[model samples]
Target: MLVHHLYSGGKDSSLAAWVLTRLGYEVELVTVTFGLLDNWRFARETAKRLGFKHRVLKLPVEVLESAVETAIRDGHPNNAIQFIHEKALEALASMPDVVRVSDGTRRDDRVPFLDLPKARSLEDRFNVAYIRPLLGLGYKTIRELTERLFIVEIRESEELQKADYEVELRHLLRERGIDPLEIFPKRHYQSRVLGWKSL
Candidate 1:
């Protein structure tokens, strides 16, 4: 079956894509861009290294910003992050010939996680399977496995301005003269694979 893996060039998403490949699925690495700034090229490079096809989907900055604004008003960035993820899934589910959609969400992931109810509804609505290969693994295990398979560059989330959903949203807010700190929490981290070495 064909699987569209939501890729971020980060450990979890990369590992999720790897897992799907190992399971004999034809995997395509997909990175969604919110039309402000993005590090999607890194994800494309990682997909090339892993021998997978890559796609970049662009979403309107205004759409994502609305979600961020709502989340900030609600007192948590998780709501904004999850909103973007759900929208991404919804977009992927609408694509022709895409029967399976997957992401890097883990059991311990609080932000950007699709709850069971949402997952079921997406499946029912789109007639597609939503897969999260890293859903059962914790951060420690994911880190260990990633170390063995890829050379990664870790950085503070704020430093990687276009690396993930939150960072991109922060950039948008800043461009509009709003303080990101007024919305997002402190001390977030992000990772990207520099290269992969055979284990």
Candidate 2:
């Protein structure tokens, strides 16, 4: 069966796509963007390196607006990012061709983690399977696997323009005369898949 994996060009999502491929599923990497930036192209490049079909889905700009508003209200990006993640999943699940939707959300993820209740709701509403290939793996194990299978470039989120939701959120904040650094933690590092480590 075919599975669409929400990819951010990061190690976790790349590793999740790899795992889904090995499990005999035809995996396609899909990146969600609000059209504010071309960051999704970075994810498309990474998908090419991993040999998975890739595409970009443009969500309504209101999605980013809502997320940014939430971040501004909460004084942190956590809840806002989680809100965007769930919305992205919902969009993917509702696609006519999508029977199964997956993401890189792991046991250690806090911001974009989908709990059992939310996952069940998604599945029940869309009549599609919601899969998390890395759900059972923690950060350490995911890192080990990614290290062995791919070459990754890691840097502070502001420094790396990968396809994750944060980039557009930051841009929107800046456009509104708000500094993203105030909402997003400065210590956060984002990864972009460079290529596969030659086996």
| The candidate that achieves the highest TM-score relative to the unseen native structure | 2
Clashes of each: 0, 0
The residue ranges of model 1 lying beyond 4 angstroms of the native Cα positions read: none
Question: How close is every model to the real structure, measured as TM-score?
Answer: 0.93, 0.98
In model 1, what are the clashing residue pairs, if there are any? none
Instruction: List clashing residue pairs in candidate 2.
Output: none
| Candidate 1 per-residue C-alpha lDDT over 129-181 given as tens digits, one digit per residue, 9 for 90 to 100 | 99999988998999889999988888777775234577677777787787787
Q: CA RMSD for every model?
A: 1.6, 0.7
| Alpha-carbon local distance difference test for all models | 0.83, 0.93
Stretches > 4 Å off in candidate 2 = none
Alpha-carbon RMSD, candidate 2: 0.7
